[model samples]
Target: MLGTDDELSYWVLVLTGPQRGKVWLVTAVGAYPYPYPQPEAHGFAEWVQHWKTHDGWWS
Candidate 1:
């Protein structure tokens, strides 16, 4: 997890997986999948890069 707010409404920017490189977002727990799996970009740096260009997340 590279960045996030103190509030625990969601475990934002969470890194989970065997190797711990996957990036999950916008959920109360890790990889819950109720709202979003949201894990698209693999590595933290890659996820950041995607965030820099993604539509809704950046807006």
Candidate 2:
């Protein structure tokens, strides 16, 4: 999960299987390994871009 600066928090996740390489935005409730909703992107490149954009913020 990729955490955001917000308290409730937004997360970017890379899924596997049929949805492999897809990106998803999740709303975190408690701690690590938060529950995710659905995939927001189905492309690997899109996922990479999202990760890079948030990497600096969440790193």
Candidate 3:
């Protein structure tokens, strides 16, 4: 969940397997920016790139 002076936002993830299922969640809380829009747009590309770049590092 994200909270700001003006608005709030939240993110949730759920994963399921053949037998066992996994669930993950993340929350962000910060002050709203000068613009009235949401922050998800600004960092989305970077986030996806990073995820793809480092997602397999453990392997």
Candidate 4:
């Protein structure tokens, strides 16, 4: 099982410049946000939910 600290830590990366519209989910270890909904959300549930509620994703 992942520790509380590990489970709670995450990041979102939005690309700029030529890449433009790419957004990513980054973590202390690492992550790759998928092209589809609810992909690989296991440890990032809290953060993903927060992002969704706060005008992110489909909001």
Among all candidates shown, the one with the greatest TM-score: 1
Backbone steric clashes in candidate 4, count: 0
Q: Which stretches of candidate 3 lie over 4 Å from their true place?
A: 1-42, 55-59
User: Against the unseen true structure, what C-alpha lDDT does each candidate score?
Assistant: 0.46, 0.47, 0.30, 0.43
lDDT of 2 by residue, 1-59 (tens): 55565766655555666655544445454432221222234454654564577744222
Off by over 4 Å in 2: 3-5, 28-40, 47-59
After TM-score superposition, the amount by which residue 42's alpha carbon in candidate 3 deviates from its true location, in angstroms, is 5.5
lDDT by residue (1-59, candidate 4, tens digit) is: 12232465444434455423444444565655432255543234544555567744422
Better candidate by lDDT, 2 or 4: 2
Residue 22 in model 4: lDDT: 43
What lDDT is obtained when candidate 1 is compared to the true structure? 0.46
Q: For model 1, what is the alpha-carbon lDDT of residue 12?
A: 40
Task: Locate the minimum summed-lDDT window of 10 residues in model 4.
Answer: 1-10
Put down candidate 1 lDDT per residue, 1-59, tens digits, no spaces: 45554465342444455635655554355443212434343556665665677633322
Residues forming the 10-long window of minimal summed lDDT in candidate 2:
31-40
Full candidate order by TM-score, most accurate first: 1, 2, 4, 3
